[model samples]
Target: MTTKTSQGRFFEDYRLGETIAHAIPRTLSGGERALYHALYPSRFALTSSDEFARACGLPAAPLDGLIAFHTVFGKSVPDISLNAVANLGYGEGHFRRSVHPGDTLRAESEVIGLRQNSNGKSGVVWVRTSGRNQRDEVVLDYVRWVMVRKGDFDAPAPPPHIPTLAATVKAADLRVPKGLDFSAYDFGQAGEPYRWGDYAVGEMIDHVDGVTIEEAEHMMATRLWQNTARVHFDATLRPDGKRLIYGGHVISIARALSFNGLANVQLIVGLNAGAHANPCFAGDTVTAWSEVLDKAETAVPGVGALRLRLVARKGGAPFRLRGEDGTYLPEVLLDLDYWALVPN
Candidate 1:
């Protein structure tokens, strides 16, 4: 008898410096926009109206930043984290170009670092992945690390080669899209009067909105992104008999909730760091808040950058993050530091 089923790559199959060209190019469309709005409470004016986008000097409304992130992340799952224990963290992310409807996207990754866990049952693999459009232009680029299970626990561990990643993406490295002008931006139409100059560092805003996660919505979102992580869909995968929610799902909802406070924050240009501090499951009501970390002027005519720390939590006092020991509180689900573009 012959069996012909691939079980995906285990920790032993990975090597530093290996370049993987992920398969299955996806062409996005209006359907994605519709589904995203249905799944989350996204109401950013620029992404909601073509006319609003045009006034901001864009040809059309670009897909939500998280949609572009999920598409790129999904393509690398099979090659990178199909047999993963957990998707660990993200760092140094940037959107180089806006993704519009009808654009085809693909992904490629290069293994940059590796480390064997002390338990010897799993290892962490770090890869820098790039999502490119049909024009072969990179739309998104980021580095993420995942903890993957080892098919053979007895296999010799690979020498550790952890790369020194930057703690934050430099403001100068941020990509302001070509012809992106906010001089004519309308505050009323955009739903917020705050601009780059209006936000001061050290200020915190509690986005007082919450959304309870639903099983059906998460499944639909995972399928939409073509994400094949078993833990997100298979209840039997864990001993708890509950399906794990995708981290990106938490990110999108948190970002959507932030709109109430960060209404005029237009483009997500850089993701400096992020961590899924705790597991999020269905029925958990998620809320978010943001702290202005830093600010910088951009070379763009009317654009500026605001560095922020976006936090997602459940059932916690507002603005609380870490506990006494300097670790994230049990109620905290995500801690993301990023930079967004706004009109100066």
Candidate 2:
């Protein structure tokens, strides 16, 4: 008998100290690489040219580290926080290795902490998730928490381990992708001249634009993330015959759209937390907006630091986020908090 029954998740299912393995393995390909560059317009030549990469000392152009992070993180959504009330924060994030095309990625989560709300209705669930490539090599590791419903109010609340997270990562903490030689970097063709100092804390900007998605686009993305979940591609997987969208696609699109205002964001330093606030499907016109959360200084000359929140939505007035109830709107598809290095 098929045991598939989903009407959206609520906070009650997570168990502290228990592990939940997210199904679906994804295998990224050239198509995803192409889409990633197109979406972000990133000028990190190493990602755009094999020749440049060879000169810098890599086997070939590598996928964006953010792309790999998004792919790995997106895999946990369904099993962990589909019904989450809020993403608490992220900690212990480190990229242990690089993932290239043709590499299949799989993810697993270990619940490390849990705390029931005093009201007894909902609680926080924390997990340290690790993403691994086909070779079983670690690609990334991070901690995240979400407010979930109690499966049973009588169930004892799990212990909470809210690890201390850095407010801003130093440039020395950056894992500059190997073989990346900025010495030969082309700033003119790299897109923008604004370095780190250009950004300030608490600033907000709307990246005004939209890109209509197609089936081929999403299916390819789902596959690249090695997220084999049928919902993201197979039309027959669901009763409605609708192709489920890949969460990573939304992440990449939103990050790319964030470029409008975060154009000078040179390096990603920290990932505080993230969420796909809602489901996304084909034919959806995705748009993006950003808010500066914090700022810091990196060791690199002329490099500044900016923490940003990037949100993606379907369509409508270029308005900011808020629900009718004064909460963040449900139409919002993402709530990603991360840090980037920009021009000083």
Candidate 3:
């Protein structure tokens, strides 16, 4: 079996209410857990320390919800974002259930709307993607929009039109999965030395550290997600016999990397944009870079807001995410924009 060349589609190819079932299945495991913890000192009260989880009424320590979201969203990259120019926004996201370690994840996408650009060169596509487990239960859901290049157009005359999205999910709109409760939360081991007030606008720092991924790790991650796309797992699936690492793995890795500098960031508030600029395979070591984008005040007094651009690349370079040609190198895997709850 071989991975499809799926060049993906442009704005012209999508219609309202059209669904796109992605072709990949992924699985999460202990390694993912270790990576998650190492990448961000994320104790989260529920994700780390099985002992704490049991006290919290969980059967065991659960995988972080954000990790699950990253895995589920990563599955859509090949089918939805391969040709995207910009990821406009994400909203209406709900974590409907808790995900534990060793659970398998799968994803599917539905096109909700599309609008063509008058320039005939680009357009935007809106999609709602849902993630399910091996048991076929809904675990995550969200709406995202992307700017895609136009594939073809016979005649173009209408002026370009674009859509807008909500800045944040309202409190009433937050669906914090059935089993999550802060009532039993443990505050000691989460590993942050500061709260909201420690942060100020215009701060930047490097999330110091590197992670080296292997074939087995990437394959296991892809399979766990039920991301059936062969290239991610099957060495024999490629003519070169090289198994491709899942793009989302790199995203998760990079996000975790941000924990080093953005240590006080408590919650992922917004996903402004993201990109898997290049393909990453096993055997490449990853390093991270980050830049503060913006900041704001939040409802949680001890927590302020920080928006950042996090990047992941192969090896220890000058942290230049792009190559000489301005294209992402095969070593570069992620260009992500997100908002987090951090120290003020």
Candidate 4:
């Protein structure tokens, strides 16, 4: 008899420089967009209406950038994080192209670095994953590191290798969609009059809204993305006996809530860095706020970029991020820095 089953790749099983082609190629449709909007408070005009997108010069509305991201991230779960402790952090992420409905997407990952924990029970694995469309055009790419459990404690650890990553994706490197012109952008249709120039560096905006995570919705979102992480689905996987809400869920929720103050930020073009500062579980009420970190002009007429720090917290006052020890406070759930395109 032969055993044919996958227990997923443990820390000791990974080898640096190896590439893994993830399983399942997903073809997205407008239904995905509808479900995504239903799952969160997303209301970006460009993605919400075809007419608005056409008015902005795009042939049609593109799916939310995170939809591509989560799909790719989900495909990698079985091969990358099926036996993981936590998905730690992300860096050097860029949305190279707009993803539209009817496009089929797939993902592959290269193990870029590795480091074993002193505890001998777990280790970190870093990978650069690329999501591509049917035409082989890269849609999204990013580096992520996850802490994975070591199946065999006695297995010899590999020499540690950590990769250097960029602190931010430069404005020059951002890819503004072709034909995206905000010259005649309708502030009335967009639901906001604020433009790129209206925002100032160092200014903070409190979203002033909160959404409680429900067990059912979280489960649906994880399954929708094909994320098979045990901690997110199996109650017995954690000592607390509560399912962990997917971090992307928190990100989408925060981004949607930001519509209150950032209605004109129609596209997320670059992701500088992100961290799941703390674990989020069902029943947690998530709130968000944003601070303008920097701003730049794009070559596209009427388009500019804003570097923002979007922080999501379970509780506590806005603008308070780190503590005296230089670590995230207990209330902080996410600290994400990214660049978005807005009208000039």
Q: What TM-score against the true fold does each predicted structure earn?
A: 0.99, 0.68, 0.63, 0.99
Q: Rank by TM-score, highest first.
A: 4, 1, 2, 3
User: On residues 1-344, what C-alpha lDDT tens digit does candidate 2 reach at each position?
Assistant: 77687744445566556777777778977777787776544455545667756654568877777777878777887777655544555666766666788998888998877677888878887888988998888788888776766656676655555545555444356554554444454455446665555555666788887777788877766655555444665577567788767666777777777666665564565676676667778888889888878777555544556778888888855556776677667667777877665545
lDDT of 4 at 214: 96
> Which segments of candidate 3 are over 4 A away from where they belong?
1-15, 19-46, 50-62, 74-108, 113-126, 131-140, 143-188, 234-241, 316-319, 322-331
Cα lDDT tens digits, model 1, 1-344, are 88898789899999999999999999999899999999999999888999999998899999988899999999999899888889889999999999999999999999999999999999999999999999999999999999999999999999999999999999999999888899899999999898888888999999999999999999999999999988898899899999999999999999999999899887899999999999999999999999999999989988999999999998888899998999999999999999998889
Which pairs of residues collide in candidate 1? none
lDDT of 3 by residue, 1-344 (tens): 99966667656666667788876677788887786565443545445667766755557776777788878777887777666655655656656667787788889998776777657788778888998998999887888777777777664533343445565444433333333333444445556565545555555567778888877777766655545454565578567778777666777777667666565454564566676676677788878888777766645433456667788888646356776888777666787776665434
Query: lDDT (0-100) at residue 47 of candidate 1?
Result: 88
Best by lDDT: 4
Per-model clash counts, in order, read 0, 21, 23, 0
Q: Which has the higher lDDT value, candidate number 1 or candidate number 4?
A: 4
lDDT (Cα atoms) of all candidates against the true structure: 0.94, 0.69, 0.67, 0.96
lDDT of 4 by residue, 1-344 (tens): 87899899999999999999999999999999999999999999999999999999999999999999999999999999999999999999999999999999999999999999999999999999999999999999999999999999999999999999999999999999999988879999998999999999999999999999999999999999999999999999999898888999999999999999999999999999999999999999999999999999998989999999999999899999999999999999999999999999
Return the candidate ranking by lDDT, descending: 4, 1, 2, 3
Instruction: Pick out the ten consecutive residues of candidate 1 with the lowest summed lDDT.
Output: 191-200
